[model samples]
Target: MNQGVQGPADTGVPAARGRPAAPPAPSRPDGGDAGPDTDRERAADPGTVRGEHTHSERPLPRPRPAVQRSSVRGQVLDALRTALVAGELAPGEVYSAPALGERFGVSATPVREAMQQLALEGAVEVVPNRGFRVVERDARELAELAEVRALIEVPVMLRLARTVPADRWRELRPLAEATVRAAASGCRAAYAESDRAFHRAVLAQGGNDQLVRIADDLHRRAQWPLVGGPARQRRAELVADAAEHTALLDALAARDLEVVRALVGEHFAGSV
Candidate 1:
């Protein structure tokens, strides 16, 4: 089980990954070790440096600051979204705020705040004091979202395929390649972010900001990974999906309207 969030009174906070360690303290002017007087003085003062010269002599690090609950809530909400997509959080299953807070290594306040936003997005429903229940999406609802997206996006994609400059398509190649690398690495979070970026770059070429935003929301809802399984199979599936992205870019660059349209339809269909 995931450990609970460390509060101010806790002994230590989990170190953030990839954070560089502080530099070692400079040696004493006389090159003498800290004497008992120095140790006693350091014990009484939080700011004094008193440790061995091999390590940083600064005071122990404290728990991460939680002054900005709003920012923290946004991060928690994103994590919840990924968890839901990965099948780590099941549909129709009720989850308590404390449980989610512990899972996220945050206080219950921010977790509750995040659930409220998810409720607004229709991803979950409040259950009074019991917490929130994940909302189940039926096939009809998924179909409807796809239909709306197709209506708004398919025409734009088709038009961009014919009208957009080849230079623009070339510009998007890096984003498509990033998705492939992310999938090949078998990192779901990396792939998800890169996948969304690839789609957004494609849609933005049409020059319709509102349409892009709407289509992005629909895409996210449809892209949730409901099937949980072995890592190898998941990696293969992700690689296949990434290949489709590359194929779509190739078709667009070639100005193959028929192929582009067909690929777009297949992409949307795969999501549902």
Candidate 2:
């Protein structure tokens, strides 16, 4: 608040530790030095030489530059990934980069970058001389990812129930509520988004970043409505999924890993 009273030599500049602070440079013809040079220095003494300013005893943290907007290519890539998961880009289909670039209002460069990212993530396969092909999920890989998530995430939620601070529950309840509302409203996309939030909340224990990232890919895959019989084809069919989450929460509140594992396993299998 005080801006530190321009401490020490009191020139009002934040100084780096071993550098000699410079004296204020001569003002420009119109007025101030219309650039960053002025902000960087302040007079340690009224009439000192250019290099006479002393480094501040107390170091102030420098502010980082602001973030720039995402490039057009990045936006294109994001759009492609979304389209793929939404099933708009049908599984096992080949897409033309030029066509996609036109659809997304981008050049082939960004489209290509986005496709490469997807390919690396296993969402698409590279065909060497050919451009790229839509990724088709294998039943076995899908099952494996789902099962691994259940193994790790269910227990994490149980831990959350046991040890999560009372305040965190406040943050978590809303995601569950959102999941419920999305389901009731029959919005498949919203339901899936909220569903992912619920699992992330459960696994917030231990600040386990590595586990969280691995689980996200699997969660993203599960968000799409799986192709199946007529009963499962309705939008947001898993709206009632709250019951499954409640089951995990109950086991977590009870601090029961066995129940947690069983509940998570059932939920993962049920999604398929």
Candidate 3:
């Protein structure tokens, strides 16, 4: 007899020298094969275990926040305002949101949102079941806006002039200079924004938030192009208007209330 493990007598095949043979597959109730060992299969898969529920060891990525809609709406609002100031959006003309959206390469939703904001600003009005119509602001309305702004701003600016130091007014020189440059650029939208910035900076010295807000709103209304007026203002006209900002700053720095009142009055008069 051989001193090692024997082969099957019926098959007449010898066993391997060093390695053990794989175990036979288990039998099912119907005597069919039960396939590979589930424990060994689970061990091979990183996401699965022999006894516990399957899960990944690494964390799943977080979902990103939605920012495109609001951002697009803001962009559309700014563009619409600029178009209004630039006279691209004609007064009394109706514009559908879908048409504007097609031009802007976005959906109609953001355009409608922007148009609604414009409506609140008195720049446009809603047309029932149609679209938005640009408001045809008359010269008298523009003049009234300027008068209201002067009424609100002149007193606050004078009070600030009497109390605030020269250095504080000097600090606003850059803002005034910005208006001059924007005016020279001949972009009505640019000058409008810069002009408001200079005025807001001056009124902010009064430390009254409501005064600034009201004055700014009036200033914005006055900046819009009036009905039957030139589509774009002459560069020289814009430059002349911007120069008043620097002059106002000079008078404020000198604490000359008389000159401040005169300059403020003349500025409002020229606004029409």
Candidate 4:
């Protein structure tokens, strides 16, 4: 239901949560939900700020910029990816350009641009005379990705554990808490981005930019499939994940890479 979604199959990073918001598009500055500031401002200004100052000074929150129509292509990519991760778009499903073009309300040009990108990302296969076909991911591939993740990630995590001060996660706790809030509220897209943030924060402590980049790619390719469901469907899972953040913090506090590896192995192994 993401705003203005003309197509059903999406490709970028998408959300399979509730319908897209009606007027105030869910996507705004800082991703979504500027939160309490907007609702509270009206009480302070009482609509007078509009006359006294430019609308920018009005007590109510300044309006978010209208995302350009060109950005629609990226939005389309994100929506499609969300649906695919959520399993709404099954493997082997072949989407035609004309069909997708009609769905996004753009011509086939954008759809073609977006689909080609997805295909390059290994999320889909391009066929002759057909549009992008969903990649048929199986248990073996999932298991392989998990193994690769462990191999590529454990050393980087260990380096961070050994070299960085454990208190770094304290600096990261706010983002983790925000992600948890997103999960609790059933905001799939927000939660996904949050999850990505938490992992990167930990890797940042490792101090190796190259390692961080590799770890990121592994996380995205392997982790997306595990958390695509509505947070409620995996309520217990999300709860455990939140606790795992604390566990990681504890390990970092002690500079214990062994514990980090064990925790990571347990987490990813369970997912596979």
Candidate 5:
């Protein structure tokens, strides 16, 4: 026993003298010694792992709400159509999807989709590898559209003038006033939409859905800017045109067929 057992001084260990021994240095997986600088680096880096079960201190990124693609496409389409009606998108000009998308603060995909819808409406045509070209429409084509509309709508309006009550026609006064306000704003697109609303209200009184649909389509075509036509229509002219809605409403309330026919004919003629 005396040969095998050693005293504290003979053992040569720090713990044997009642003092704690130094801990072993950490090592990397590759067996390299991890110094004080390595521990400091790991502590400084929020993304770095420390112990066996500890994770990074970095927070995850917040999730974003997704935007609806269809809503974006529809908005692009509406904006393009308004631009066309306002004559900002000139007839016979080619507009690339990338260029339009940049202008609208959107990606090219929605612009392309909107352009495709315009092509289907005959407002634009697809150009191979180029873009879409706005369809050039002449004064004659616009005149024809107006004439067809007059043919369909004048008779119905005249009929409504005879049968519809005065209160019903009075109810359309607000719609007519809306057109006036839109015209005063000097926005062609707004006036065009309000004008159509007034006409649609008038035609709705006739209770002919098919007739209204055809007339509405023709009215939209007639509103498009004509090639070689005035770049900007005079505000006075728009106001004058808008005033006719009120006059027609008055005539219908009074059941004055003669005045209604004259106003209706003159309105269509002025459209060309």
Candidate 6:
């Protein structure tokens, strides 16, 4: 969540950031950008002899210039990731870059670039002419990710609960409280972000950046929302989840390892 949520300055890209971000560049005068599905052309029937075929192949549509402000790419990537987590980009369904570009009010070039990065991260897979498809995971795979997170995070939390100074754990109260407020507000975007932030802060207590990063990756995968699930119910579930964070903080502050372990286990169970 933090990865693609930053401004251009954070990334050191020659891109604009802040309020009222720069407008997208205009389409090339050379007619490089495709104007939606209006330009669709039927493929020639290869079964027919070349001489007999009346259909001529249209040149592939050229994507606009790729020198877009990196902020655009960051915004597109964040929006795409939100769609994935919100189930708008259903797992296993093909989504075209041009279509998504139109949805985000930008050229297909930057959208395609963002999708390429998602592909590299295993969030989506390239589909050749079809664009990309969100990677699907079954119940077992989701559970496996949760288990890996617990394996990586729980021990560190256990250690920190007893060894960390009381003030250090107390210092994270605002982040934990933010998750609770977000959960109560019933906004998936707010809750999802605060949830990640809360866990990330907790994992950071371990003082191992690598472990925190690995656990954060697992946390993202494990929390990918289900397609066509009930939103109201998910909100309610988030409220219940926020309770776990409160309990975890309380347990850690009290240095109760047994309660902390149980709270962590229950927090991860049936998640995502």
Give the Cα error of residue 94 in candidate 5, in Å. 0.3
Residue-by-residue lDDT tens digits, candidate 2, 58-162? 345776433322467667876775576456777667887878888987777778878988887777787776678876665676687777777777667667667
For model 2, the superposed segments whose C-alpha errors exceed 4 Å read: 1-71, 223-233, 254-259
Clashing pairs in 3: none
Clash-forming residue pairs, model 6: none
Q: Tell how far residue 80 is off in model 6, in angstroms.
A: 0.9
Q: Which candidate is the best by lDDT?
A: 5
Per-prediction CA RMSD (Å): 17.9, 14.2, 9.7, 23.1, 11.2, 23.7
Cα TM-score per model: 0.69, 0.64, 0.75, 0.65, 0.73, 0.72
lDDT of 4 by residue, 14-119 (tens): 5556876234423334455534576565558766445654323325686654466558778887777766655666677799878877876778876777788788
Model 6 over residues 236-261: C-alpha lDDT tens digits?
A: 78888987887888899899999999
Residue 54 C-alpha lDDT in model 4: 34
Higher lDDT: candidate 2 or 5? 5
Candidate 4 global TM-score: 0.65
Each model's C-alpha lDDT? 0.78, 0.66, 0.85, 0.68, 0.86, 0.78
> What are the per-residue Cα lDDT tens digits for candidate 1 across 30-134?
576544466566677765444344223444668676776668888999999878666677777899999999988998999998899888777889998899998
Candidate 2 residue pairs in clash (backbone atoms < 3 Å): none
Each prediction's total of clashing residue pairs, residues at least 3 apart in sequence or on different chains, is 0, 0, 0, 9, 0, 0
Model 6 segments more than 4 A misplaced: 1-68, 227-233
Q: Is candidate 2 or candidate 6 better by lDDT?
A: 6
Model 2 RMSD vs true structure: 14.2
Model 1: lowest-lDDT 10 consecutive positions: 224-233
As for lDDT, the candidate ahead, 1 or 5, is 5
Worst 10 residues of 5 by lDDT: 50-59
